[model samples]
Target: MEEGIAIRAENICKSFGEGDSYIEVIKNASFTIHKGELIALIAPSGGGKTTLLMMIGCVEEPSSGKIWLGDKQVFADKWLTRETRKIRREKIGFIFQAHYLIPFLNIIDNLTLLPQANKTDDKTARAKARELLKYFDIAEKEKAMPSQLSGGQNQRVAIARALVNEPQIILADEPTAALDMQRSVDVVKMLKQIALEQKVAIIMVTHDERMLPYCDRIMKIEDKTTIFEEQQLQKNSTHSD
Candidate 1:
C-alpha cells in the first residue's frame, strides 16, 4: 500500500525584502496533507493562501522551514535541487481559476502537452490523454477546440490535463471561481471524489465558504499564521450532496 501522507510542512515562513522594507506574509505556518484528503485553504484576500500553496508546489521559496513532498524533503529553507520545475511537473498538479488551455490546439493536444514536455512518447501521451478525457466523460470532444466547449466542460478538460501526469498532489487555485453556484458545488464534489478515488492529496485555495462543507479539513491564515480545522464529516457529507 502507498503511504498516506503526501505533504508535510514545518514552521514555514515567507517574507519579502529585508530590514526596513521587509514584510512578512507567512509566519510559522505548518500543516500536513494526506493522500485521499480534500483540503480547502480559505482566508481573506491577500492573506497568504496562494503563497503557502505555491511554496508547497515548489513554485515559491520559503524564508524558513522544512517541506516534504511524499517522502522527499524538497526544501529546508532552500530548495534541495535546481530541478524544482522537474519536481513540480512530476509530483504536483496545478489547477487555476482560468482553464488556460491552448486555444489553438484541440482538446487532446492541450491535454497531451504536459506529458509530451516531460518527454513521454507521442503514442503513450495520446493514449493517456484519451483515457483521462474518457474518465472525465469528455472523450467524444477529443478533437474539438477549446472555444467549442462549455465552461464546465473546459474546466473538466483542464483538470484532466492536470491529472494526466499522475501526480501525487494537486494544488487548485480558485478552481470553481468562474462557475455558477450549482456548477461550483458540482466541481467541488467531483474534486472530493477525485481525492478519495485517485488517492491523491488535494489542497484548494478559495474564498468560497460554501466549499467548506465539502472539504475534509479547512486550513486558514489568521494573523499571519496558518491553522487547520478538521471538518465534521457528518456535516460535510450532508452539505456536499
Candidate 2:
C-alpha cells in the first residue's frame, strides 16, 4: 500500500449460503481510498454498498481476498489480527443514517460517554467533547437533549461523536438519508471540510446523486464490481485559472 493510503481492498469477494444456494454480493471488488479524501459509494438497493463498507470496517468478513487499513494488511481470506474490536475502536469511526445518540443523555454527556468508556479521563474527555461541539457550531446546545435539537443539530452532534476518537477513517452509511435537501447539502459539505481539515479518509455510502458534487471521488458498485468516477473539480479549477 502507498504511504498515505488509508484503505485498500484487493480482489475482495463476499458470498452468502453454500452450494446451490450461494450468492456472491461482491466479486473481486478492489479500490484504494487515500488520506484527506472524501469518497462516495453509490449503488442500487442490494448492490452490495453496505456489504463493502462493512468489510472495510471489519464488522463483516470477506469470503476471499485481501484488505488493508493504513499500512496493516488486516484481512487476507481471513482476519489477520484477532483484535477487530480494538482496531474498530482506535482506527475506524462509523456514522449511520440515524444519529443513534443516547436518548436519555444530554448532548454533552452523549458525546463524552464513548471516550470515557474507552478509558479517557473525565476531564480530558469532557474537554475534547466540548471542543468538538464548538467546532460543529453546537457548543451552546451542550445541555440540550437529543429530542430538543433540530435534525441538523442532532446530526452535527453525531458527527462530533464520530470524531471524538480521532479515527483515521470514517465509514458513513447513508448519513444524509434522513435529512432535508438543504440539510443534506450542509452535512456533506461539513463532511468534506472534515476530510480536508483532519486529513481523514471518509467513505460515505449514499443514494443521493446531488451529494456527489461535494465529494472528491465517487465509487459505484454493480454486478459485484466497483468503478471510480472523479469529480473533475480540479479540472474545472485549472480551466478557470
For each candidate, the alpha-carbon lDDT, in order, equals 0.90, 0.90
Which prediction has the highest TM-score against the true structure?
1
CA deviation > 4 Å runs, candidate 1? 234-241
**Candidate 1 lDDT tens digits, 45-152:** 889988999999999999999999998999998999999999988998999998989999999999888898899999999999999899889999999999999999
Q: Residues 6-38, candidate 2, lDDT per residue (tens digit)?
A: 999999999999999999999999899999899
lDDT of 1: 0.90
TM-score of each: 0.95, 0.94
| Clash totals for all candidate models | 0, 0
Q: Could you tell me which 10 consecutive residues in candidate 2 have the lowest summed lDDT?
A: 232-241
